[model samples]
Target: MNITDLKIKAAQIRIDLMTMITAAQAGHTGGSLSNTDILTALYYRVMKHNPTNSKDENRDRFIASKGHSVESLWCILADLGYFPKEELTTFSQFGTRLIGHPNNKVSGIEMNTGALGHGLAISVGMALAGKRGGKTYKVYCLMGDGEQTEGSIWEAAMAGAHYKLGNLIGIIDLNGLQISGKTSDVLSSEPLDEKWRAFGWHVIEIDGNDIEQLISTFDMIDHKSDKPTLILAKTTKGKGVSFAENQISWHHIVPTVEQLNLATIELRQQIEALRKEEN
Candidate 1:
């Protein structure tokens, strides 16, 4: 897909996120919004998966390490026809499969995750499994900047590099803000890019919201041969919603009806503009 088309799809995902969270009345809106573009770039353009057979053995894998942002994954999975979009309304409610965190019970969900720093390790195992089976499928994991504080992340990093699991690609959602405050103030992961490189992984940084850059970066990663790839995607905490943008407090807050309407309008406007550009 072209950059403009990707942008439009991202806007639609953002809109779907807003609408789903609003209807469900509970979710991690901020993180969900922040990571929409990255997820869109993966599910729509980068990852190789068959929605009709979500568990296909040779399909690419995606692990949501920052699983609190499952709403974005849920919305995109629904868009990809993993489940009915109408099921999103049951999110976080009693007896709902669409919980705030991802559950593999849902089709197309590769891992059940919510705890921080677990995804990379799981992805390493998946990549190792693929290699053992002589499969060409790749494994991708998206982790939050805050989640890096967990020591297990670095351990998994070292293991991935040691194993030379070049089929594994880890993308960090560097939105800066976490639930409590700025990630730097909460726990500094300064020199993040250098840290990954020192661990023997190939690292690249990009504006997470830019679909073109994201697509290009994914293509670049696909051509890499030896080391595991890590993309440090700098993003706004509550992207595309004016009121929630960069606000840490919005991390798990459900949008008020007024706020939801405003977000929906902004996303629609963005989508319209992208469509105009295409025309």
Candidate 2:
């Protein structure tokens, strides 16, 4: 998809996730909205994936380390036909594979994530295995800034560089806020770029919400380098909705009926604007 199309797709995804969350009456609203464009850029434009052949060996892999903000992923997977889009209504319901977190039982999910910092570790293992097996597949892991506080993430960072797993791409959603409050206030993971560089990974920073920037940055990743790459994606929590954007309470709060309606209108307008730009 072109830049305009990607932007439109992202807006629709934001609308879809918000509706799903409101219907389910639960979700990580702020973080999911913040990272919607990042996920859209990957799944729709950058990543090599197939919904019909979910287990294709050579396909690129994506691991959502910040698993709590999985609403955008679930919507994307369903839109891509990994499962029937109708099943989205069952999200977070009893006995549904589409629970609050990413479940490996789901067709496109790589691992059962949500345990905070384990994603990069597992991604390093996948990238290393892919290299050893002589496969060209790449592994991409999306993490939240709040998740950076996990010690395991740093350990995995070291392992990734030591292994020279260039095929491993780790993206941090630097939305600046977490469930409690501002990420800076909760745990200062500042100097994130310098820290990753010191850890021996190539670091790139960009506006995570900008689809064009996301596509360009992702395209620049070197899959055969001796060092892994880390994308410090600065984003805004609750992006795309005026009332919710950057509000900490929305980090995990389900939107009320009125809020959902307003959000839908805002996103739909964005979609329409993007479509016009496409022309």
Candidate 3:
């Protein structure tokens, strides 16, 4: 899809996320909203995968390490025809396949993630397997800034660089906010880019919500070899919705009916504006 079209699709995903969360009455609303654009860019543009055969060995992989944002992933997967869109309404309810975190039991999900710091290790294994089998598939992992505090992340980072897993890309959703408070206030990872570089991974920083920058960065990753890529994507915690943007309180808060209505309206306006630009 063209960048403009992708932007519109991202807006739609934001709309779906808000609606699904409101209906479920429980979800990680802030993280889902913050990560929507990056997820949209990956599914619709960056990743190479067969929606018809999600298990295809040669297909690219995506592990959402920030698994609380599973609502956004589920909405995108449904939109991509991975499952029936109706199933999204059952999210967080009893007997629903769309759990708050991803489970590999689902047709399109690659890993069961939510615990943070686990994705990089899994991604390293995937990359190593691809290399051993002489397969050309790539592995991508999306992690939150808060998750960086886990020592496991650095351990996996060392492993990936040691193995020279150039086919692996780790994108950090550096929104600078975690559940308790601002990430810096909690645990300062001041020199984030330098830290990744020291680990021997190629680092790129970009505005996570900017579609053009995301596309360009992904393209750069596609061209890089012999070193893993790390994209430090600076983003707003609760993006798109006015009441939620940059507010840590909405991290797990269920939006009130009025708030949901206003959010939907705001998203619709953004979508319409993008559509007009396209026309």
Candidate 4:
């Protein structure tokens, strides 16, 4: 999809995520919204993978380390025909695979991820393997800025640099908000770019919420570099809905009917505006 179509798709994904969260009555709303465009850029534009041949050995690998916000990921996976879209309604229900976190049981998901700070480690290993095997696949990992506070994340960071996993890409949803409050207030992970560079990563910073920027930055990834790449994607929590954006309380709050209605209207307006530009 072109940039305009991708923008509309991201907005539609926001609406779908909100609808699922409202129906399930639970989800990581703010973080999901913040990471929406990042995921859209990957699944729709950057990454090479097939929903039909999900097990293809050469397919790109993606891990959502910040698994609490699987609503957006789930929506994109379902839409890609990875699974039945109807399965979305069963999200968070008893005996359903579409729980709050991602699992290997999900067709398109590469690994079972929920524990904070694990995604990078897994991606590092996968990238190393791909390098050794001379495979065409690349590994991408997504995490929240708050998640970087975990010691395991740094451990993986060190490994990524040591191994020079060029095929590996790490992206942080730097929305500055987590469940408790501002990420800095909870556990500051600022100066992220400098820190990643210090750890031997080639870092790129961009507005994660902007589809065009996200696409362009991903395109600029040095897939042939001897060092791993880290994208500090500055984003706004709860991005699409006016009332929820950047508000900490919405981090994992399930929207009420009124709130959901408002979000639906807002996202629809955004989609319409994007479509108008396309026309």
Best candidate per lDDT, number? 2
Error of 1 at 248 (Å): 1.3
Worst 10 residues of 3 by lDDT: 217-226
Q: Write one digit per residue (lDDT tens) for candidate 1, span 174-212.
A: 999988899999989889999999999999999998888
Candidate 2 wrong stretches, greater than 4 Å: none
Model 4, 27-111: lDDT tens digits are 8899999999999999999999999899999999999999998999999999899999999999999999999999888899889
Cα lDDT over the full model 3: 0.91
- Weakest lDDT window of 10 consecutive positions for candidate 1: 218-227
**Pairs clashing within candidate 3:** none
Per residue, candidate 3 scores C-alpha lDDT tens digits across 137-183 of 88999999999989999999999999999999999999988999999
Q: Estimate each model's TM-score.
A: 0.97, 0.99, 0.98, 0.99
CA shift at 177, candidate 2, in angstroms? 0.3
